[model samples]
Target chain A: MNDAPVTAPPRAAALALGDDALVLSHRLGEWAGHAPVLEEEVALANIALDLLGQARILLSLVGDEDELAYLREERAFRNLQLVEQPNGDFAQTIARQLYFSTYQLFLYRQLAAGDSAFTGLAAKAVKEVAYHQDHAAHWTLRLGDGTAESHERMARACGALWRYTGEMFEPVEGLEVDWRALEDSWRESVAGVLERATLTLPDGPRSGAWRAGAGRQGLHTEPFGPMLAEMQHLHRSHPGASW
Target chain B: MSSSTDWPLWEVFVRSRRGLSHTHAGSLHAPDAEMALRNARDLYTRRNEGVSIWVVPSSAITASSPDEKDPFFASAADKPYRHPTFYEIPEGVKHL
Candidate 1:
């Protein structure tokens, strides 16, 4: 019997992660035609494009792109809870972006430097993320120090999103991707930047809890159902539709 | 400096990744030179197009008035003989 090496255990897991990115990118694109300001709209669109591009690479590396995106059920998504949250308002959207991009920036930086099969992907992805971080950091400074209402809104948005922060760093089973060495370093780096911007790093939650343990196991938050239906409708309804 | 009541608009120029010359990117609102530069970095360099950026307050710019259009430099257009063209091809001009 001849043998080719079996696929890595993490393949499905990583594809799930990639799907999270792709879905979130699509959601962010909804803001493109309707952001509060023209400049802000362009910024969000750019960030969305970057993430979508990253998702494509990550998905292709793992398996078939369409299947990775469409075949998966709502429960299979592994995005942090923050990303799946709806864009409630301008402040809320920016706050979600800032939180996710901050975390993604850290995650990508570590992966770029680490020993991983996805080193090439991570390296290029990290280059794009530098801009994402800058975008978020800039807005954080402006909104935090802006007019009184803006300041209050930012604080509230951060407070709401902070609870989702833990999901970013929380480990998932069989994903087995490790940034253990860079964990503290990443945290400190983001903390310093936030401090310089004069924004507080929002705490996780008052419930003293995180929605964990199920992301990788095909379990998801309540919002995932509608997001999936919208995302996968065409592909599911008309199988084999293509360019 | 104290008399300045509003934020001075800054024009950003970015030199993407060791590029020789900086190109005008866009503008951002900021109070001073240092803040403008930082904002420029945040807005322009975030995409990593730039290894460096320059921000100059829009007010500090001294530009020739478009209203004085014909009088200012219109004289140069008629002076073609003021060029080196008149003497350049005389005899053997080595490597000219």
Candidate 2:
């Protein structure tokens, strides 16, 4: 093994974002065979795969994909709680997607403008995030207006998720400017969409402020451990093996 | 506006970039025109495949039935002059 000490922290930061994508994608994939509407089931699955693909590219960029994806312990994972929180119901899933994808749209747009070393990757990602945002926005409008029951559930989902959304913009220590501006822009955009969808943005302890940190510092929620165990079981059980 | 009618079916067309013709993409369901356009963008243009999109309710499309294919198209086949082969170019024709 090469013993060179890695200096710059941005590489690791990239992995933090990548880890969020991987974990959230795993949750999103759970809806593949199980969305309320058949069409939506397909749509969610496709979007999940898109996120997973992004995760793969991102994780691989930071370190070995296998190590980043499968070898890490739970606490070692850096995914935000927003991505790790359990997906509740259809409303909850839509809420999560709306929250995450909207943020992703802003992040990608800024990254495309920024001179990230991964310019090509950021360029490709912008397209996917734009569509993901559209998907989430459509769901937000539908569930918010569909029926009294749906509206109530969606509202609850937004309130529950709104708090967790804070961590998405929590800047990496010493890398604050990199993420802070994007976070502010994302909020403005999300607010507009929420207004149009008739959804209320929550104001509470969990609203766009850090309930926890060190997802950037490589600390993760409780869910990360079990998630990694499952994701890595097959690969770790038989290392150096061909598919 | 029958409540019994199913959600509107939208016909999708995507123009991948400027100066390109909008080509048929596929179809989806949405509650309104705006949502229809958004759905088409999400489903068909997720990969930056299109810079522009169009969505028309499938009900609005009036397609000729397959049962009338022969009767509808038979006249065209007999119009040999429509092919432009009947027109002879002069010896000096530059682009004939």
Candidate 3:
């Protein structure tokens, strides 16, 4: 038995991944009472719970999970801008899930295969993320092909969020991932799903000036501020109070 | 919400473990067979309560009329011989 103390996971990578899970979990939690149907509400809540569990595990690796999650300023969060985007509509939320879950599944699969601090967590999380990806893909297909209104909404949502996807390929300081390969696989996977759903890939610039990125650099979009305020409200109002 | 009313209802069955037959768990609404199965998973199996699931359109199941329950189920009520109550005790055969 190796008795050496385990070193802490790289802070930057943990924060980025943890923040992504935490923020997205909160957004999904927002759908609790508003989902279109009872079954869908339960499904979304289950996915949210899974993500919250993952966020707790990842955040705990860095520092006090509550402090890092509840006390962080908007600019201090390292999550990708894709997750912080508002849940515009059911279609929009599904579109965001399709994009982020695909990226997360692939990233976690890579991490699980390698020797890293994230290996154990990634191994477990990959299974949950796979289901998340499947759920999103199914919704994407149904909404994209169901009816004129649904298809239009789905298309609009996919296009609206296309710009933020490029940031997922940006290399963080600590994670040893092949960004190019990850991005390529992500494009192929997403394109296949969209094609099958009868929706064309959005024709827009994914990166460069005027496109979103830099969330990993502790910079965030406008909506993140309000979201942070809401997430931190109960904790911030009564410090260290527990039920 | 209005659109969900247009969706079909499905009956969910869950098999708690291997070698056991599926038991009717409950019902839920979904757009199709695929979504119904996924929804059933979230509803019935999230607590580790099931190892397998089957979702059938509520329309597909032809349930006996509750109004005719007496006539439909009356045949077996007076037949004690139809049950295997005479079997000897088997210590390890729990489900039987």
lDDT of 1 at A146: 76
| lDDT values for all models | 0.70, 0.75, 0.92
- RMSD (CA, angstroms), candidate 1: 5.4
| DockQ, all candidates in order | 0.15, 0.20, 0.65
RMSD of each: 5.4, 4.9, 3.2
lDDT of 3 by residue, A1-243 (tens): 135565678999999999999999999999988988878989999999999999999999999999999998888899999999999999999999999999999999989888788888999999999999999999999999988999999999999999999999989878878889899889999999999999999979986786888899988889989989999999999999899
Output the number of the TM-score-best candidate. Answer: 3
Give the per-residue lDDT of model 2 (tens digit) for A1-243.
135553443775677768878988898887766665545666777788888898998887778887777777776777777787777888888888888888887777766675545455667988888888888887788788777888899899988777677777766542334577777787887777777778777775763234554465657667666766777898799986676
Interface RMSD of 2: 5.7
Query: In model 1 chain A, where is the ten-residue run with the lowest total lDDT?
Result: A1-10
Q: Which model is ahead, 2 or 3, in terms of lDDT?
A: 3
Worst 10 residues of 3 chain A by lDDT: A1-10
lDDT of 1 by residue, A1-243 (tens): 125453453676466558657867987888877776444566677778888888887788777888878887776666666677788777777777776776677677766675555555677888777777776766667677777777788779877766666656667544444656445655675576567656677655524545333454566667768877888899999998987
Q: CA shift at B35, candidate 1, in angstroms?
A: 9.9
CAPRI quality band, candidate 3: medium
Q: Best candidate per DockQ, number?
A: 3
Of candidates 2 and 1, the better by DockQ: 2
